[model samples]
Structures are given as structure tokens and as C-alpha cells.
Target: MGNHVETLRWNGSAIEMIDQRILPHRIEYIACDSAQSVAKAIRDMVVRGAPAIGVAAAYGVALEAILRKNEASNVFSTSLEEGFKALAASRPTAVNLFWALDRMRKLWETHQAKNQPELADIFLGTAHEILEEDIRINRAMGEYGASLLPDGSRVLTHCNAGALATAGHGTALGVFRSAVEAGKRISVFADETRPFLQGARLTAWEMVQENIPVTLITDNMSGHLMSRGEIDAVVVGTDRVAANGDVANKIGTYMVAVLAKRHNIPFYVACPLSTIDLSLATGEEIPIEERPVDEIKGFRDCHWAPEGVSIRNPAFDVTPAELVTALITEKGIVDNTTLTAGELADFVKKNQ
Candidate 1:
């Protein structure tokens, strides 16, 4: 079941990505044969989620290498550099994008003396490695996080962090999947992540496909439900996590975290260490990507807002570490609730 949704895959000559923008309605794969095309897809959100973006960027570099495999060494190097910059520019908030590109760049630097074809093979192999590693890491995170939820747990999730969001499996939804696999009876409350409606479309669709009980509610309904004790825990996926444990995720994540704190409910961010930006001391240092105004106006081809109305469509928001109960990673869960100020930095230092 976890393998059913292939977010993106290399099909020998090109990168085939599931067109997430039309997901849960029509399953389509868009082939990207060049780094520029992959960058466009990432920027346009044809393939999203931090881990998935990272994997896509890695493949983007590989695609560039493949495209330039027959060129002169200097031309190949220049082209690869352009590819790196393009993928890096695709998204600002997801640290994993840069991480994956950096990993590929480092590998290229070490083996750059080789011919272009050999370098292309090395880059492609490394891209495949990153993809496989992401799946393994997500499964490990699922196992570690599944233990946190008791049987009959009612979990609240935002955005779409299921198999559709990653190479396979998921982060937040992976924990729910793991819990169900362990025979725990759990239900999910999916927030209809506004504008994009990832929750209402992707999350709900994934849950329903897996036969998991999922209830959909408007983005504004979380606080009310929490006040009524309908929510047991909140789990969401992050685009980036700071060294101090602050999180940058979907725009509504900050609100959900605040409400979870008010209800004394655990707010867990399921992410891989790749999403952690050690250079960023706090969430303030993380760059927020403001999406196009059309996203705020309405869904595709649907408009309700008045003409020339103002809009602030920041794709992400920061949640201070103080409000985060714990961070679920492949290594283990970091319990932020018990830590004093600045201790998350210590953890990052030790782990990093």
C-alpha cells in the first residue's frame, strides 16, 4: 500500500513525477527531462513536500548531468552549476532541497576528474540513494512515532504528509500508518488546509484509500474541536526545522500549534534530519516563500475574491520551539516540552 503512490521516479531518460496539483482527481505523471523543467515543477508545486522536493532536486541535478554528459568538461561543470542554482531557487523554505543539492554537489566535486558520462552515472546513483534513504528514514520515523500514540488515539493532522508527500510512506501520516500496522485503532482529523486544500484533497484521499478513518474539517475548526477534547494529539509535517527546534511548515501550522498548546495536547512535527537547517539558529532565519496571489483567491480556475484585493500568501509560517511538544525524527523523538530555553540548540549541536 505504501508503495502504491510513486511521488517521483527516474524513468531512465527523465524524471517522472506525479502531478500533485491535480491529485485525488486525476493521477498523472509529468516527465521532466532537464533541470529547468524540474525546477519549474518544484516551483509550480507539481511535486512538493520537503523530502520529496529534496529527492526531486537531486534528480534534477542528475538530469542536468545526463543532459550534459556529452559536452566538454568546462561546459558540463557550468551547466551543472546552473542546474544547482535553478533547483535551489525553486523553493526557499524547504532546507532539504538545498541539502540534497549540496550532497550532489559534494559528490560531484570529489569525482569531478572523471569524464562527463561517468559523472552523470555517479550523480544518478547518488540521486537514487537519496530517494531510497528518504523512504527508509520515513519508515524509521514512523516506527518511533507510532509508539507515542496509544490505541484509540484521535490524531489531528494538517497538510498532506502521506506517501504522496514523499518518496514513499510519509512523515506525519507515516506515524498513523505505523500505528495502524501495529494493530492500534486510531482515527485522523484532517484540516482542510486552505487555498491549496491539501488536507481536504490529498490527506483525505490517502486516508480513504488506506481505509483509515479520517474526518475532514475546515482549517478554522481545529480550536473548537480541541476545546471539546476531540483532539488527542496533533501531528504535522515541516518544510524546515531550525537548529533551535523551531518549525517552518504550512501557513496554518502555527495556529494549530498554538491551539494544541492551549489544550495541552502534544504537537509533533514528523520530519527527517535533512529538513533541519543547522545553520539557522531560529525559525526567523528560515526564508518564507510567498506564493502567487492566485492561490489565495481561489482553487484552480475558481475565483471569488474581489478584483485588485490585497493578499499575503506566505506559503509557510514559523512555530516557536516553546509551543512544540516533541519532534519526531528517524533517530528518535526529541521531547521539547521538558527542555528549557536553548536546550534544543544543545540537542542539535550534539546530534549534528
Candidate 2:
């Protein structure tokens, strides 16, 4: 079998990101040469998924450094700050985006004494490191999460949290990959996340590429499947995990979690430490990104909704800590009891 797909790569001169907007049918890469272009790509969903977006944002800073390699010290510093802000603003729900940009910002602040050329090299190196570390961290998460599954486990996943959603192996899907690698038989049920269809277009497509068994279901079909005892577990990736372990994932994730609980099936959230936001005390505090009305009206230029209907398209919804079975992280797993008391911060502190 071939190696896992790379979601994005720093190609010496630019960040080459797989165009997520038109996948399965067409495989193309977007070459981002400037921080502005990278920001646009993130906002436009050319490259998405919390971890992937974070990695792309780090590369955005590197692109800024490369562009300002010949500028004066003050000019370079000012432009760098602007680049960081732009990348941070590209998406608000994912803490990883802010976390990655802040890391780059701190690196620049610490190395202000270096010349533009040196700074450019340092920024590029750091971006590459971030990208590589994401894959490593995801695999570590995969190992821990995979251990939670039994033989012949059937997992229900939301959105496109496969290789397309991360730097390499995915968060939720990574767990499935690890279990399969460990010689456990496993399959997946992917929800066709509406208004985006990331699950249908990306997740299912990715599973086929990896030779993982997958079943496609509409967003509303989850509870029905669970009611019939078809789903053994529900595992999904989050854009942000609140201090209390309340998960903010794709819009339908809360429903899936609720159904999983009703069916007495384990609902797990696979995430990295970077995706956890200690600043947010609860999921209620996590910002929900609302998309343009066009997305709700149609997909990729196909209009189906009535021309005058209203739409509320919140990109994500928060699943309270009470609904979570466990929080799977690169550090370790935190049970729902620990998560509910809002003690995840304490767990992270001790582990960090």
C-alpha cells in the first residue's frame, strides 16, 4: 500500500495545500506565496480541518518572512505582526489557528536581533517543524485512541477528519488507522455533513484512498443507525475543546454525541493539546463561525434552496462535557467525570 496522503507541504518557495473545495473528483494543490493568499485559502476552505489550518497558518507566517526578507528591521516587524493577525483572523472556531500563529509570533519576538535573511530561515524552519510535529502528535493520539476500541469495532465519525483534515494521519480517523495497523478489524460510518458535505466528499473519499471500510450516511441518519445497534462508537475531531472538555466540532456533532449516549455507545473526541483552549472556561465561550448564505443555499454554485428562505449556518456546535465519554489527547485520555468538573486545565497543567 502507498503512504498516507500529505494534506499540505512547504515546497521551498510556497505552501502547497491540497484544494479541499474540489476533492475526490479533482486533486489539485494551491500554491500560496503570500500571507494574504494563505489567509484567503483558509477562509475559502481551500485547506481546512483544525490541525491542517493551524499548520497552514504557521506556513503563512513563513511566507510573510520570505516576502520581507529584504525589508528593514522595523518594516519586517510590522509586516510580520500584520501577517500573524491576518492568519489568526482567518478562522475563529479552531484554537489551533491562534495557537500556531502565537507560536510563530513568539519565535519572531525572541529573535528580533536576527537579520531578515536569518529570520526568514528561522521562520521557515519553525513552520516545517510545526507541520511535522502535527503528524507525530496525531499518530500518538491515534495510538491511545485506538487502544480504546475493541476488535471489529464500528466507528461513526463526523466531517472530514482524515488525512485531508490534518498534516498527515487524521485525529478521529487516525484512531481507526492505528487500530487497523494494530491488527484490529474496524470500519467507519461517515456523516455527510450538510452545507459542506465534508464527510461525503472528503472523509469517504479519503477512506477509499486508505482502503479503510466506510459507510456513508446522511447527517440525520446517525441516530437511526445508532438506535438499531449499528454503531459501536462515535469518534470525531474538534475545532476546539473547552477548558471543561466541552467539544466544539462540526454543527451536527452534538446530535451524534447525544445519540451515542442514548445507545450506550462510547463517544470519543480525538484532539491534540493545541486544540484545547484553556482560556475558554466552557464551550459556551467558544466562538461559532457563521458562513455566507450562499453555502446554505447551494454547494459549489448549485442552487437548490428557495430564493427567499432564511438560513442559520453555524459552522460548529458545542457538545457539553456531560455528553462526552472521554477526551482523547496527545497527552492522555480524560474521562467524562474529570471533563465535566472542568478539570481538563488541571490535567493539561500536570501533563504539560
Candidate 3:
């Protein structure tokens, strides 16, 4: 997912992809040669992210159509609908997953009059467009987010929002990348986001490759760092933004924002325009996804205590807009006015 959400390898009849389970450690591409296999992959998080899911769905349906003996039937349609239902059921936090999939469905139905091969080409083209546009949006976000900080600033970031998360550049990390390139000598304090270790696995990997100075610390250590005046700002990525400017991000983000607010350090929420959802009234309306207890039960699935200790893990949390300094988007960094989150979003849309 460095430069694209999903990578598809078409062997004239099948679609193959890299299994995200062992990413940034072991690179493995599994053959998603069938609709069921790909759908299961999506459900199991073998492949993920909004744009990636959409592209995967497109290819999944395409492969089904191409491999069928009878190409002029509605069987592909029925299978495609089932695949969409399965994929959409995998995760609820990232609304973009369903959004992109629905868009793909529409594109598929709209192009039904075209030849089979032509429709396949259309899906591929749509996937590629989403890929390229995401990269461009990341670059834009970097440019706009950089303007919010001064040179030689030390910043803190939570979770993973680097190239691995986006199609290319990234959202929150893109801001830091731009600052570094501008000679900001920025140091990133990474909070090893608990439960998933997205910070440790994805963020640390990105910082290492970019040669950015990064310090990894436990989730509880963030407030300590803030108290010592070691942090200048906190930037993080969001899965969804409510109409009230409340942001739902990887769990533990609300804590970081509260700390930032108390410390008087600027806290920023970086995201693409797609992450903002005007349908929801507030963060409370955002559905929180709860995972298995195994995450908090062990570091690497190994029990630390010799007992039946249960664990509670919520995938994401909501951060109120008041704690944020500015919202960085592809268009520019916009500060919310006294208006409500929904009204602010309308303002943003008009400006864009």
C-alpha cells in the first residue's frame, strides 16, 4: 500500500495480492484467484483500507467474469453483490470501505452495455485513477500541513499514517515529511499504538525508510513526554470525521488530543477530504469496532501472565474538534469556525 491502496496482478484470469498480515516484516503475496478467497481476505484483513477494498472488489468481480465460461450472464452480478456484502461486513469504522465499494458497484452497473473486456478495462482504469489521485492528495496535504509549523520543531504522532496507509505520500505523516524536507529537523515521537501496533509496525517502518528521527514509546509515555516539553505538536490520521468536527481515529487518539490540549501544544488532525463524513452528527454517532481480547492479552499473541486474563480492545476513538488546532486536507489547512461541524464541512466544500 506504499503508492496504492491495492495491488492487483492479472494473469488473464486471476487476481493476486500481497497478504497484509506479515507486512513490514515478511512480504508475501497470496493468490486471491476467486471471489470467495478475496472476500475472505478482506474480512480477515488479509487486504484492507478503503481504496484497497474498492479496488479489490473491482478485481474480484472482474476475475469472476473473465473466468466464467458464459460471459453474457448476470451470474457475475449476483456474485459481485455477495462479495460486496461480505467485504462491507468486515469493518465498520472506515466508511470509505463501503463508499468505494458502492462506487465500484455503480461503475460496474453503468458500464454493463459495454463489452466484457471493455468493462474490465473500465474497472482497472477506475482503480488506477483512485491510486494516482490518492498520491496527489497526500502531496497536497503535506504542502498545506507544513505551513502550520515553524522550522526545527519536534512533533509527536500516533498510529500509522505514512505511505503505507495511503496510496502514496500519506496523511498525518505527510505533514512531517514536508517539514523535514523544508529543513525543519523534525523529530517524531511515535506512540506504539496499543492493540494493533500500527505505530510500531507501520509508522516505525516508514520513519526508518525516510531516515526520519523517531522515538518509540508506550502509549502511557506520551503524557510524560508532553510534560517535559519534548513535544511541539501532535498529528494523527483519522478513519472518519463526524459532522461536528469530531474525529474517529485509531484508539488512544483521544488521550493524545486531551494531553495536547492540556499541554497547550498544538494538536492537528490530518486527513483527505474523503475521511470527512457529513452524515454523522458527532463522534458519538461513529460506530466503534471492538476486536478480540487477544490484542491486549499479549504483546505478540504470547500470554505474559499465566492466567485467564481477559482484554478489551476498541479499534478507534473520537477526538473533539475543539482540541484540534487546524484540519489539514488536500485543498489546504482549514481552521474550523465557530460554526458546527456540519456547517464547517459545508464551508470547506464551498471553498474547495
Candidate 4:
């Protein structure tokens, strides 16, 4: 009910985001004014999640346009395009960000000739709609996702897929939360997603606040735990979902999916349809960002190495479609064996 750290919040003038690095311990706000800064914030994980970044990028571009008082249409348009490119390049993989940007661009171009002063308002309004729609989709996803789980059965999840991760209650975690509140016996085992630790710090924190039972385990320890017959289902969020159902999530998520497949466990990808990229026909086309080497070598803030130890830190990894059991969207938990943009558009229509 209170202000959540993981979601995006606007306080009239500026956009505020939670500094996730010090999360579960510190509550710091990163105030963003320009599109470049906002893009960097997302690239650095100051504000994350596909939908969140998309909405933020839309507003960031609007903010950039607003700051440019020079009404020279060419100059102002160029500035806006630059801002969009900045935000677009930040994540490279999350289709939601690009989709939201394109939506804003289309609306702006459509109204640019007739309405000038209202452009900012239109941008803000479109962003609000996007955020609201995401909440609805996630809520439906929760309900649809709940149906996937047997009543009074425990569920296992990886990463932070809850309220903090998006505009409201998260995708995969959305279903998990609804199921628990409905008096279904559920326990969540969160993989301590390493390098970034979205699981240990963000997901675990949310679970604790909600008073949901959670067992935190190291990312590598997931297979061991499941092998010991400790897991029932594996639900995780996606940075992007390929047409073939291959999921790009946090670096270790592929491993979780692999283990789930090995254990014959049900592995589900819970996400908004916006995260789906129909253009990229295959997962191999998705670019995986290899983060700073320091991420894999040492923890944030506190240094562990002597002087210079090279570290290879890849921000995300891809899980092939072969391992995914199902794709959970607002419309329903459907298998994307033959995926299409129509499925996404239909999903939106169904939610409405």
C-alpha cells in the first residue's frame, strides 16, 4: 500500500527511482530530469524492468522536449529523436522500451501539426496509460498464473518479479502473491540472483515485507535444492521473450530453466505481452549485454580484490525455448509454440 522502491514514481516535476544497488538496506532516490540521464539510470539498473523502462523512456523524451524552449521544429524534433535513441540503446533487448518509445513518437508526430503545447501532456498521458495497462495485464497474469499452480502447493521462483519490478504487482510474482492471499498454501524459494542480486535483495525483501514464506538460496544452489525434491514449480520474469518462447532474463535464469527441465519441473515465464518481440524470430538474434567485469569479481561498494582482478560479468543470459514450459501473459498462460503479434494484440483485447 505504501510507496514501493522498485516501481517508477513521478512527483510533478521530476521522475524518481529507487537506487537498487543499496536496496534491502538503503532507500535512496535518483531524480532524473533529462532523457540521457534517465537512459543511463536504466542502463545502470537505477530503474529497471521492461515496462518500467519503457514508461520512463517515454516521459524522459517528453521531459527533454519540454526543456527545449527553442520552438524550431527541426531542432526540437532532432532533440527528441536523440533522446529516444539514448533510451533505446540503453537496454538493447527489452522490446517494451522500444514499443513504448515508438508509441510516444507516433502520438507526438500525429499531434505535432495540430497541437504543440499539448505534446507534453500527451506524452504524460500516454505514459500513464501504459503504466495502468501494465498493472491490469499483470493482475490478469497473476490470476491466470494462479491457475497454473495446484491449491496449497509450494512454488519456486527466481529473481524479483513482484511489485517492485514494475508499475505494480509483478508478473510471475503477481500470481504467487494472489494465490497466497487467497489462503492457498504457498512457499517461495528465491534464487539469490548473483552479480545484481535482484533475488536476495529485492525479491527477498518484498517477500519479507508481505510476510510470505521464502527460502533464499544461492543461484547455483537452485538445482541442488530442486534435486532434493524441494521445488514444485519455477516461475521467473523475462527481459525479453522470443517468438519461440526463449526467455532472456537475469544471467543465471537459463540455468534455473535447465534444471527445471532436468527435474521435470514446470517452468513458466510470467510477463506482459509488451516484452514479446515478434520481429526477432529467434532468441539467438537477441543481444546479451556483457556487463563490467567487476560485477562478477567483487560485490558492489565493498571491494574484495587486491588491485585489479579481471571479472567477466554478463548482465543477462538466454534460455532457449526448449526449456520453457509455458508463457504467462495477462490473457492467459499460453504456450507460444506458434507465437505471433496477434497473440499479444489479442491478449490486450482480452484484458480490456
Candidate 5:
């Protein structure tokens, strides 16, 4: 396995997250002392990925509890509700964020009769559990996903789904790490995810750090490589998966899935159970977050596009379930190509 990277941690007083916005160049941590600060960090992308956001939001709820431990019951309850709403509004596409918040909220409601200090301790403990559980879940998903690739497989991935994206081991990248650990030779082709450039910066950096063979390609280069039979399989991490197994991932994921279908290459989505939202009937109902037009202009401060040109920047796109060969989950591998909404929902319920 690759070197374990701690994406975020609770230091007893504050939740500290690695600033993903300036990664691979400047290594910095943003200390969130309140739920508002944690929400801001999520909005600004100081910490990202579905699992990482969920864990961070868990800590955000705990931080709010700690911050309001000495306040009156009425004030404490009102302030905590405000914190929940702020975090819930930070990101719309990732179901894990709302999942974690709902879990914490339910726990708080169930134990609200306790004193404030005790309640704060319970929240902190639960947050710690969520963080640790995420790491375990990712490793399990890695094992299940790694089994899908044979020896000497060339895996193509989009964006950064490595350890930087999650709590410890990643989702999609975790499969590569796991396969390599099991004595399977796996090389990687990372897409230079545009605007943010997470793959060019974060994914390449992670693979290089762990001595895994990696090739960087522009976003448009995947189809060309696949046409040449250079790509073995496509593995990606999802922000959310609908009841019918429709996947919502990075903005370019749908194009990649369609290309994989044309090439007859297996396309896999490494998804955790928390990312699955059974309430959504289909991908058409998934809310796509439109980022600021400034992101389309250029990376950071380097602007290349001419000013005043309108840019539509949807942060993510949905891939139909039929395009997905399978979904590698912590419980097991889900055959998604022929999965029905009812079957998928039943699987989720059985697992839960």
C-alpha cells in the first residue's frame, strides 16, 4: 500500500484539513475552529471528495457542540441547528455530506437530555468513529475493486481519488494501491482534469510518491489511447450514486464512460455505501453544482482564456447505469450494467 496520507484530523480543539486548493506546491492545513469555518472550507474546496467531506462535516458538527457547550439549552439547540444547515448547504451533489450530518443530528436528538458538556463529548466520540470507519470502508472497497483488475493492468482514472481525496486510502486509487500490494503490476493513466487539474497535480503526485508507474494525459486524450488499445480499464470515484445505479462524478466522467462502452472496456465506479442515495429515482434528479465561471478562465492566477467569454462550469456530470460495468463497494462488487432501481435499493437495504 502507499504511504497513508491524513486528509483531515481533529486536534481536540479544532478540525484541521489539508488545503487541497494549493496542493502539490504548498502543503498547508486550514484549522476550522467552528462549524462555520468547516462549512467555508468545504465551499472553498480546502478539503474535498465525498468521503472526506462527510468526515469533515462530522467533525464540524462536533466542533459546533464543543463551541456551544456552555450556552443555555435554547441557545445551544438553535446554534447547532444553524451549524447543520450551513454544512448541509456547502455541497449539493455529494450525498455523503448530508448522510453524515443526518447521522450526527439523529445522535444529538436521541441524547439531547444529557448536559451540554457530556453531549459535546458524545459528538466528538461519534465524529472520531466516523473518521476511522471511513478509512476501514475505503480499504474494504480497495480490496473488492482490486480483484477486478488482472496482473499488469493499465488503469485510467479521472480527477484525484487517491489518499488526498479520502481519509486514508482512497476509493479508485486505493484499488491500484491494493493491487500493487498484492503483487499485481498496475500502471495508471491520469486525466489532467481541467480547470482544477486535480489529476495533473494531485493524482500524479500521489502515484509518483508511492513509486507507481503513471502517465499523465490531457482530458481529451483518453479516447485516443483507448482506440489504440492502451487502456485496460477505467476506474473512477463517485460523488453520488442514484437508486438505479446512475453515477454522478467529476464533470468529464460521462464522456469517459461512453468512450469505455465504445471500446468494450470495463468501467468501474468505486463507491462507498454512504454515497448511495436510494431516494433519487434516477440521475436526472441528481442536482448538478455549477461552479463559478472564474474556474473556467484558468487555474489559480494563471488566466489564459479571453475575458468576457461566457463559461458554463458544471462541477459534475451523471453517467447512466448501463454505461457502468460494475460498482465496487465495501460490501461487494455490484453488477451495475443490468441493475434495476428496485434491485439496487434492495441491496442497499440488505447491507444497511
Candidate 6:
């Protein structure tokens, strides 16, 4: 299946990214001239989705190198370190950000003998390659995941895991796209994904663009819909997956997983190998991002909460390994029921 959207592109000079904050209403692109600008864009939600953020961070590193090409070795090294730190700090939950940055850092370190200008070319080229590779990875994962869905399946998803979330294609939504392409007439139920509405804003927009059958519902309505036997399966994208198969995704993902478990519906998590953090033994060790309380209190200047109300907004929640039916990756699916931490370690090693 072809990607219906291009979330990020390089123009030989700067990184151009879709501004996700105004999606489904206004389509806008933002150009990042410096590493700081790219970092700000990620933190500001101008660019998001784990894979997209990773690609953006890689470009941010490249932009830093391009801007600091004239600096002396010591000065360039300092600036490069700062650039990595800034981009990595933009979002803490996505392991892809750290993975991409680490790749760039290692590549830069390997060519330390070269001049700064020479290293600049290497950095930008590698970043471009990373973006391309991500698109390919998403497609491969899509194919593997698509097989899991039968004809006329109604998949429930949280947040926006379509093209807007990755370099192209998507993780969870990619499976749906591939399944549709394989002649399986499937529909999607997207949760509004509270405080951000990534599902309502981005997911719905992407599906409508491709003429995919989709239904928009509030986050709280997922269980009701599932109980009515309206949902056949749950497929979601994750920020990080632990060695034990635990998943950390959008805030309300855990609740959806629990509901799926109760209804005996299969809950699947779609992600690339880059999203797997084998270093973390379990989800308890995964860092969850705490967003501002104001986000829950209002919706882009529209406030509904009463005065003096206290709100807590966590960007993600960990779904225990036991809750996941299986994990869909580029390598294939790993059934959580029989999968073990040691087996996952081996899978990561062989895939890597």
C-alpha cells in the first residue's frame, strides 16, 4: 500500500514537517532551520508519533552539524553534544528518539578524523537514510500485521498511529492499511484520545483521506462499543515495549487493553524493532511523561472543568505484558501468552 501522506521531508537545506497541532482543520508545514527549532517542534507537538519524532530528531542532529560546520573541532563537538541532549529531552517516552540520536552520535564519532564540513554531509545523508528506512520498516510491519486481521474485522485504535505518526505508513494503522489492500474489508474505531484528540483529529483525517471506513468515538465510549460486540480487535502503536512484552502507549491505552481483555477480544500492539527497549526489564522501569494539567482542563481555549479542580495528565500508561494478545513487528508476531523475556531478548538480538 502506498503512503497517502508525507509527514516529513528534507529540502536539501532544512527539515520540513507537517504541523500536527492544527490537523484536520488547517494543514500547515513548519521548516526547522536549526536543531533547537526541531527540538521545539517535537516538544510543542508540531511533530510527533514515535517514528516521526525519531526521524525529526535525526534531522535535528544533521541540522546541528550543518550549522556548526565552520566551528573548530572542540567547539563543534560541544555543539553536537548539546544538540543530542536537546533533541533527546524533547520527549522521554519514545525509545526511538534515543535510538536515532545514538546512531547519529556513533556515526559522527566514527568519522571524527574528518573536518566538520565533511561530517556535516555524512550526518545529513544518514538522517535521510533513516527516514527512508523507517518508511520501509513500517510497510514490512504492516504486511506482517495485516495477516492477523480477518476479513470484515473492526479494529479499535487509540491516538493517531497512521502516516502522521511515522515517516510514512504507520504502525498499528499500517496493519489496517495493508489488510485493506489485501482485500480484507476492515473498519476502524478511533478513540478521541483525550487532552490531545490525536484520534479525533489526526487518525480520522488520515482514514478519511484514504477513504478507509472509520468511526470516531469518545475515549470513554470504547468499552461500551466493545461490549456491544462492535469491535473485533484492538491494534495500537506504542512508545516503548519492554523486554517482558509490556507496552507503553498513549494515556488511555491501558484502559482499552483491559476492556479488550474483559471482552476476550485480542489486543495487539504494532511497532518496529526500534521501539523495543530490551534494556528495560519491565514496564515499571519505563519513564512516563507527565503533561501539564491545563491540557486536561481545556481544549484549545475551550474550558469545561469547574474552577478549583485538580487535574493530572500522563502522556502514556503501561499495559502489562499479560494484557497484550501479541505484538506485531517487522519480524513477525510474538504471542504474549507463550513469549518470555529471554525469548524476546533473543528475538531482538536476531533482528538487530
TM-score of candidate 1 against the unseen true structure:
0.97
Model 3: which residue pairs collide? 3-167
Over 234-348, each residue of candidate 5 has an lDDT whose tens digit, in order, gives 9999999999999999999999999999999999999999999998999999999998888999877888899889899999999999999999999999999789759988888
lDDT of 6 at 103: 96
Instruction: Quote each prediction's TM-score.
Output: 0.97, 0.97, 0.89, 0.92, 0.98, 0.98
lDDT of each: 0.91, 0.89, 0.74, 0.79, 0.92, 0.92
Q: How far in Å is the alpha carbon of 345 misplaced in model 1? A: 5.3
For model 6, where is the 10-residue window of minimal lDDT? 1-10
Candidate 6: misplaced stretches above 4 Å? 1-3
lDDT of 4 at 29: 86
What would the TM-score be for candidate 2 when compared with the true structure? 0.97
Model 3's lDDT to the true fold?
0.74
Candidate order (TM-score): 5, 6, 2, 1, 4, 3
Please give, for residues 4-100, the per-residue lDDT of candidate 6 as tens digits.
5579988879999989999888878899977899999999999999999999999999999999899887888898898989998999999999999
Error of 2 at 266 (Å): 0.7
User: Which residue pairs of candidate 4 clash?
Assistant: 162-170, 293-311
Distance (Å) between predicted and true CA of 116, model 1? Answer: 0.8
Please state the error at residue 350 of candidate 2 in Å. Answer: 2.4
Candidate 1's C-alpha runs over 4 A off are: 340-352
lDDT of each residue in 1-352, candidate 1, tens digit only:
3757788888889999999899789999999988999999999999989999999999999999999999888898899889988998999999999999889989988996788898899999999999999999999999999999999999999998888889988999999999999999989999999889999989999899899999999999999999999999999999998877889999899999999999999999998888888788889999999999999888899899999899989889999999998999898899976766566666666665
